[model samples]
Target chain A: MTEFIPPGTRFHPLPSPFPMKRGGALVGAHVAFETWGELNAARDNAVLIVTGLSPDAHAAANEGNPEAGWWEPMLGPGKPIDTDRWFVVCVNSLGSCKGSTGPASMNPSTGALYRLDFPDLSVEDGADAAASVVRGLGITRLACLIGNSMGGMTALSLLQRHPGIAHAHINISGAPRALPFSIAIRSLQREAIRLDPNWNHGQYDEVTYPESGMRMARKLGVITYRSALEWDGRFGRVRLESDRPDEEPFGLEFQVESYLEGHARRFVRRFDPNCYLYLSRSMDWFDLGPDGLRQIHVDKVLAIGVHTDILFPLQQQQEIADGLREGGADATFLPLESPQGHDAFLVDIARFGPAVAGFLATL
Target chain B: MTEFIPPGTRFHPLPSPFPMKRGGALVGAHVAFETWGELNAARDNAVLIVTGLSPDAHAAANEGNPEAGWWEPMLGPGKPIDTDRWFVVCVNSLGSCKGSTGPASMNPSTGALYRLDFPDLSVEDGADAAASVVRGLGITRLACLIGNSMGGMTALSLLQRHPGIAHAHINISGAPRALPFSIAIRSLQREAIRLDPNWNHGQYDEVTYPESGMRMARKLGVITYRSALEWDGRFGRVRLESDRPDEEPFGLEFQVESYLEGHARRFVRRFDPNCYLYLSRSMDWFDLGPDGLRQIHVDKVLAIGVHTDILFPLQQQQEIADGLREGGADATFLPLESPQGHDAFLVDIARFGPAVAGFLATL
Candidate 1:
């Protein structure tokens, strides 16, 4: 019912009428993935990599494309992931718009964009979609499963829903469930999008998009993703020093504001607002307690947390490790001191890479 | 010249052509203040209380009205302020819209609301207006000056601009200069107002106001004002759990969101968006360093900071105390440990009250 292209960035369609969590189903569903290295004859040497909110299936440079990906530093021939030793599978998340069937995709039943009509998704649903892709690749078991942030929640859900599917798991800067402070931050982001006059209740055309709302929301996101210490050390009330004195002196006063606005503009160009709303809500809905961890039958698990991460925080990672350990799993906790906050997993290659590599070596 | 009403809850007008910080002046400018107790015959026992960004001159219940004020807990007969022992003067800042000369006030030259046409203001300008009010009451020197947040900056500016005006000073949860983190937070809030389609560049009438933008901005403010630890302990993943499941499950899911939205709605009702933008920018521009503190002619200074304050961290308050001490003034630093964060001075009376009372007893 779904076509499967070759490895190295391909799409795999789900069976028709794919059921979702919270009582809803999606039709003509598919997932996009990219692979590195070769799959062993036994199909047991595959390492699965899940991404954060905005990243895509392109995790690193491949033979066809020399361009670097979001996690380029952690992947390569001799990098932490060690693509030479294992086949690395990176899946674009279920609700994302980057080469994936999401809110931007056409609805088979209505012949229109899914938009707000997309069914509510859970981390478990995203895991099921990724599982379908894995099974289609003729893999019975994963050598290792790794994820960061929201991806971390999906990794836990994957292990819970499909027990014994992975030999080892690594969760980086991920939470068992979204905290109240983070939920409040994301709720405001969604409100920013919905308040845009161009949003038109999620029915805007491409030319008249909710760009301002998305831009403002991303500005807020960048602020929360980094630590105050880091911002203080870096910006420190430095003026932007613009040449135009006649322009309105409201938004572009501080260097940090300019940096945030630049990042917001770049993000709004790539991300779909509806997809952001759905995925952010999905993160809020994610919950994996002792019972859920008890269902995960992995051999070894390593939980990595950054000290400065306010969104997920170090305590959430500790909870994950504790939950897995309490459920009779070999779980190790690695806490890192980095100023990058929740984005440390994506930025600090020196600290995060070694911990992930050391964990993979044992498995 | 502007008219001056009686001592209790009245307006003191400044001379014609009141100059501002960055050029441009306000004609027929006046300052609104409320007096508690009586100025001594010597005119030397008056306590001047400058307000934060949102508060008004109504610091406590008075004879005219029995309604409680914003800082009612801290300002009674035997409270930390000690109205029974000393006369108190609370003045609304220069650019605020609470019965003060601000964007909402009429411009004599144009015979219309100043709105966006209002001149830019600074902490020093606010201090000058309050100084004029004190002189209007025929008091040359104040016993003490107390301010918190933006008001603290104004008090410091007053000491720098006109030395020996106040005998002693107390700065609570305020920084000598606004940091990049706080500037970025406030910048986004202003952007929210400017981006509102109904804003119309701060010229909207009462009916078609930029209420959504102000509501969203206030939500952001509440997030930054409080600590993450407090929210985590108080509202960690608690759902609102409505009985009706069909009422658009977007914003009303989490209790935290509901809390923030409720505060935002109440703030939007009471605050003018244009004044918010102006005052927020002024806070960003406030920077008083060694050069400024060296001009202080006070005998004693007390600087209090909350450990959980992310906006104005304890380190900033420590800097103020250290700067004043280094400049040969008797400055005492009190670091508070409260989960209330920057808003601790407003919420936690048990801790902050004793510190202020003890310090005032010394003065």
Candidate 2:
């Protein structure tokens, strides 16, 4: 499968033979990014936005791309991140198929898709790639680093590896390490994909693209992304208007089932399955240990989370704040009451936006 | 696949032309059951236990069956249910494969496995079947009715349809109706089974079974059965002692994944996938609605749930209690602080046992 890159995505060439965290190197690779607003004369106003698993670097419509990005509500000129005040640059993680070199990308050395041949991708490798991109943009130090979801893990890694790379940091809905429950969910997801005969050991083409596997995985993800309270409020016992005939058993019956099917159908073809497997496993392998946050030398840190997020519970955000505080950073932990769960940071912009903007203002 | 009946299960022949709730009739049908302790001449000391989707009639070892049953810890002589004082009868649900006439059973008219050809099975049908067994045993009324998990749904139906059938009811981790979240989860599970090529519209056999699909469905069920807090407490980030080789990219790496794998493997063949699909869908179709409980005429009701149960959840239990109370029954809602989630009633017997015993003692 070809990489699903969005239009107007910019690339930054990495140094040849870029060493990966888990004992392998990438050759002739590049990181994907998109920027809005301009860096100040001193490049001191630059802000970096690291994203979650599936989002591309096109965070918001800029001069080059006219399409609204995933986080458009919180990233435009007059929005929460406020591009007019902060020169925001969002980079797609290294192991994503969204205009970034990943398992779906063609290997320069062998002129073939990396697929399973790709080296083990760790969260730290993504941090290093983002760091390379920041450096490539000629920014010595960022005003603030913002990470959401998986990117939150990457931000912690970046701060620990490249000390003082940013003046401040905001970690949103991310954990210090992969919890067992989260690991189990992702493991079942991967199992769903691999169990699909169409997956065929990642050699699937568009014709045999493991659609059912991807659909199941995406449905499982959508289930976790939102809260049960929200589900009950939205579709409580609501059957579909056009329920299937009895002959076709297991057909869509409830509004929730239909909603999941529609969501999963839209996602299965849009994202590369191999890239998903790699990124998901990378999160499972991530752990900053107990004292890993003490290595980060940022001036201020804000860890934001929602109470309804079962995947990354509110306590994880508390842990991040407490860890950063122990590191002598002016840290604050803000737990929001949004009922959107793990995906609150993406959809509950009314709540997340103010917290982010307020933190950035303080920074 | 043959029915997986344990030894010493007794069958009660239903009236010929046994009508189902949704529409259809089973000819020469039988309901499976087992008895512990003797019923006094008055028959007022009789107690009935209806079970979840998977459990059989052998709820505990008796003179006929030495093998311990699913609820062995909470049932038997001098145990929580206390067969020493009250005669206990456990009946396998009509649509289950364990010694009951489910999709795996041979159709008397067709001389072939019913499979998908089986009529739509509703929770109400199971209630009617259980009611038949009770009436067959010459018990005009039960001293107490015990329902666990899906059995809770059946119990509610039985109480509503067969008014005054049980003087008291103890609903353990059951809901009045299926919630949207639970429906979505079960829908995905059914989809997993149907998507398997080996399933072949429920034409699977012992040699060509849909093992992978059943494995995925069972794993998903196991994941939801337990709470995230319990998972973290039990398997928190514990890696496997012998991790799989890198050649198998999606192989098990963590203890939680291994646990799910072991669990799914053990379950895939032990139960019929078609029966699982039928029973799962039946729950989705079960909703007693806002006033469904008002039809039940039990003297007292006890609804017990754990705080961490994601599948049935605590609110459902509260709803059951509140609805029963509204129906003029002396009802008590007991929410336990077990981290084991929906399966807590099965594993956390220390808490469940006493509450059950206390309720039965009052009855």
Best by DockQ: 2
Q: Residues A116-225, candidate 2, lDDT per residue (tens digit)?
A: 88999999999999999999999999999999999999999999999889999999998899998889889988988998889999999889889999999999999988
TM-score of predicted chain A against the true chain A, for each candidate: 0.95, 0.98
- Please give the lDDT score at residue B151 for candidate 2: 94
Give model 1's docking category: medium
Q: Give the alpha carbon lDDT tens digit for every residue of B1-363 in model 2.
A: 444888888999989899988899999889889999989999999989888878888888888889878889988888998988999999989988988788999987899999988999999999999999999999999999989999999999999999889999999999999988899889988888998989999998999999989999998899999989999899988888765633477788898988998999999999999999999999999988778987667899999999999899899999999888889999999999999999999999999999999998897
TM per prediction: 0.94, 0.98
- Per-residue error for A253 in candidate 2, Å, reads 1.1
| Candidate 1 residue-wise lDDT, B1-363, digit = tens | 012112245778887788887779878888888888888899878889888888888888888546788788898799998988779899989988876799877888888888889987777789889888888888888889898989888888888777788888899987888888898899999999999877888888779899999998999999988988899899987777773332753556888888998899888868888889999999988888647676567888999999888788898889888887777789999998899889988889999889988888876
C-alpha lDDT of residue A31 in model 2? 95
Q: Scored by CA lDDT, what does every candidate get?
A: 0.85, 0.90
Point out where model 1 deviates above 4 Å.
A1-8, A243-246, A289-295, B1-8, B243-246, B294-297
- Give DockQ for candidates 1 onward, in order: 0.71, 0.83
